[model samples]
Target: MSIPKRVAERITNRIKQFQSILDAQRARDVSEADTVTLVKDLLSEVFGYDKYAELTSEHSIRGTYCDLAVKIESKLALLIEVKAIGTELRDQHIKQAIDYAANEGCEWVVLTNAVEWRMYHVLFRKPIDKQELAQLNLLTIDTKQDECMERLYLLTREGFVKSALAEYRDRKEATSRFMLAAILLHSGPVQTALRREVRRVSEMLVDPAEIDKILRDEVIKRECIEGEQADAAARRVQRSAEKSIRRASEECEGSEANPNPSESPPVQDAH
Candidate 1:
């Protein structure tokens, strides 16, 4: 089965098996740290990350140690924090995750209890403003089982991580493209300085009006060509129909002159 389908089944089965236990745990009230341990085990067994480890509670330059950190290929890829089942995830949780990400330079962060999982992208600014780019609630792991787990698994997949990274890279690329285009179009002093700097390294100049004209001309030409083709097709059909009608009229006249007693007039062909 595909990963998504498999995750769906696993979530369903887990919910059925653990619903009562989960409810009892909620009733009994477990600590966040204990929940973190459970989550770490789940990640190791279910998600197949054997090298996962809980960070020591030592305070670092960025912040306190994160709940769980996973290192893959000598790079920290995942960071997570655990909260109690009843505790609401707040901005503080996001702040802590961001600190861990800043210190570890990880791309992803997860904050959750056993029931609710929230994943985020660690967005980095020039002067080091640590904030999350996006946050997705992966699972309640109790109520909305299938949907939650499927989404959670999607977050865990390598392709999904790569896609997020590609998006960041594309954002940078788009910004660069826009800046270059702007410098090429503008005639101000700042634009002049930018142009000289750009020309020192390369030999390309941008013409905004030329680009606009090219696009407009292409669209108009395409429409005209399509319209001409349609007109030609209509004319061909009209001629064919006229030819058919003339032939039918001649045939009818011939029949009338011959006067076949047993036969009726032939029907005209509607071409």
Candidate 2:
């Protein structure tokens, strides 16, 4: 999900320059038309879309119009539904865009208000499902953060042309297994392996049932990585924990050297 150095720099600068202004406008209730134009500008400047080509607003499905579409080599890739900047994206909004995608045979549909972008994968299989693959909230994100940019990069024109978003979804699904492994409650392989490790490290023999009980109580701390998001915050938590451990270790060394005087080990009570 890494963007090219040049592309990343451009996006970072654009967000830094425009986010506050956009926020002020959105606070005043910008019109849908204006939001759509902003979305196009984001596509062109941040996502690498050529405004004249590869991006279109005239796309229609069975005479019904989608707000925007991205095409590669004359093939429609995704349909987008734009709402006013302050609009809350709902399931109905997503379904509307998905209906457009399905009718047009487009595999992806996005619903956004220039503030929050949500991407869905349209499954063509029976019992049709619109699975949400990713989402980004521009309002709260720090664009300079690597994890933030990585997710945002998936929606770029180069990303869409190269199927980077799809690849990102696949990678997320695969990595999700590890996250599940960390917190599985069932007697799954992950749980079994963890129990084995616990037994190996325990001072006394540990029972599998004990591990199950402990897990049911959910006493073990775990960090969850959602979708394609990086574990950046988790790393911060780990560093803090390591610092506390080192401080404790240093205190213990000092205590040992000075020998906390409990009257010098009861002073010679035997005397």
Top-scoring candidate (TM-score): 2
C-alpha lDDT values of all predictions: 0.55, 0.76
**Which pairs of residues have clashing backbones in candidate 1?**
none
lDDT of 1 by residue, 167-196 (tens): 643454334433333323332444457556
Worst 10 residues of 1 by lDDT: 178-187
TM-score, prediction 1: 0.48
Give the deviation of candidate 1 from the true structure as CA RMSD. Answer: 21.7
Off by over 4 Å in 2: 177-271
TM-score of each: 0.48, 0.66
TM-score of 2: 0.66
**Candidate 2 colliding pairs:** none
lDDT by residue (tens digit), candidate 2, 1-271: 6578887888788776668867886998999998988888888877778877878899877887778998877899878899999888887887778777777778888899998999888877655668787888877878877888887888887777678878977776555643343335432455678877776787566777877677646663443433222243334445655787899999999999888665465455765
